[model samples]
Target: MAFNYEQYLRPGKLPHIWCPGCGHGIVLKGLLRAMDACHLDKDRTAVVSGIGCASRLPGYVDFNTLHTAHGRAAAFATGIKLARPEMTVLVVGGDGDGVAIGGNHFIHACRRNIDMTYVLCNNYIYGMTGGQFSPCTPMGDKASTTPYGNPDPTFDIAKLAIGAGATFVARTTAFHATQIDKLIAEGIRHKGMSVIEVLDDCPTAFGRRNKFRSVVEMMKRFKETAVPAATAAKMSAEELQGKIVTGILHREERPEYCEQYQQVIDRARGA
Candidate 1:
């Protein structure tokens, strides 16, 4: 039986604009499924995105969606969650949008430990604005800007989120569809800031330049190399080299930003 995603999607948006082999659609689908899994009130959920291929997600979803400026989805989500603490705020964006231009906001959001979620679609390259080497682009990877190869070391997105003080952090690839939904659902249930890094594919731009023969090859690579966090812990660094770590990396209870601020206001009121 086909899973009907029409209810979550906006009307008259039947045909999405994503490319044939793009994995952003799958990430969005997993997010919606996670929303359902948590039994969230759709009316009270707000989705925000920055300018990029993955950022276009909010426009097609039926929710309080904001298509914001480039690399500002985290900032927008922080504001929305603060203004309406009852609402569930979710920020979606690509690697370029989240870590390149928006790195400041991203780190600070995690530092704040706000009651919100950030779903980062790390496709390695800047897919929409031609294939540019993003902050997450692996060393020696080819992009339009890096004809010879990208020399800069890649950012481990999950580690960055943890280092920045996110209460909850997880990583998964497009191949791990069920894991994506499971992690996002858990993130939503957690009270503090959560970062879910989804290593997705952008076949048209990233794939062609990186020498991926086909979408199948790209997906097969993920299946072979993605290691669970628990398993990775036992393996030596040399043994786990070139492997993508999946599963929840860090999680801890924290006084969410809004609640802490509210307490200060109440104390000042002397009531």
Candidate 2:
């Protein structure tokens, strides 16, 4: 009862696969803390993930975990939530898996407003599959796929979710560990679909190529660049460039997909 992580951790996988300085472990810790804070039933919870360094989270958690194919976490999570309406389904993955290859699914999931939660670990690069540019990778950043500089525009994940009809959306960073945990806990408690975009770090893949001295330095940069919601509202667009805005971006009431489907079933049976 004292927030025992061992109760929710997988057996025979004591040590994680992430690198020493990787932020994935930090993100995982935040997620576990969130679950504990929410007091979610371990047996009734399902964590679904796609193929990526961060996607390895589902495997380590002791819940009903599913390790799905690349860029398919949202799709798999959707199915899980639809089938098991009683379960608290959560989706976890990296920027590459959630936004790059899984972009379509992500949008559809948001539009459906299913009762679920999505935690996107945005490390800016494809850490597991080599140091490649990801959808959330900042413009002009250097990566193995973008040796010179990335030409594409980066995604504002919280904004996208808001526009796509997600009932709840929040953004936080691994640097703000406690905030991330609280955001995840609140998102999970919300009824409709919620998204928590956690900006993490890939020291090996992203930091080294970008001239960051160390993980601590990168985290410091995150702290400096981050702007709180109240502060961001007072700043102009010009002043907000390169700034990471973190907080609850949006929240609204909506009917969950599965619940609506059940209503239709009830109507048909009555008819």
TM-score of each: 0.98, 0.97
Candidate 1 regions exceeding 4 Å error are none
Task: Output the lDDT of residue 94, model 1.
Answer: 96
| Residue-level lDDT for 205 in candidate 2 | 95
Residue-wise C-alpha lDDT for candidate 1, range 75-142, written one tens digit per residue? 98998998899999999999999998999999999999998989999999898888899999999989
Q: Write the per-residue lDDT of candidate 2 for residues 1-271, one digit (tens) a residue.
A: 4657787788898688898889888889889999988989989999999999999999999899999999999999998889889999999999999988999999999999999999999999999878999888899999999999999998889998999999999998889988988999989999998999999999999999999999999999989999998899999999999898998888999998999999998999995
Clashing pairs in 2: none
- List where candidate 2 sits over 4 angstroms from the true fold: 1-3
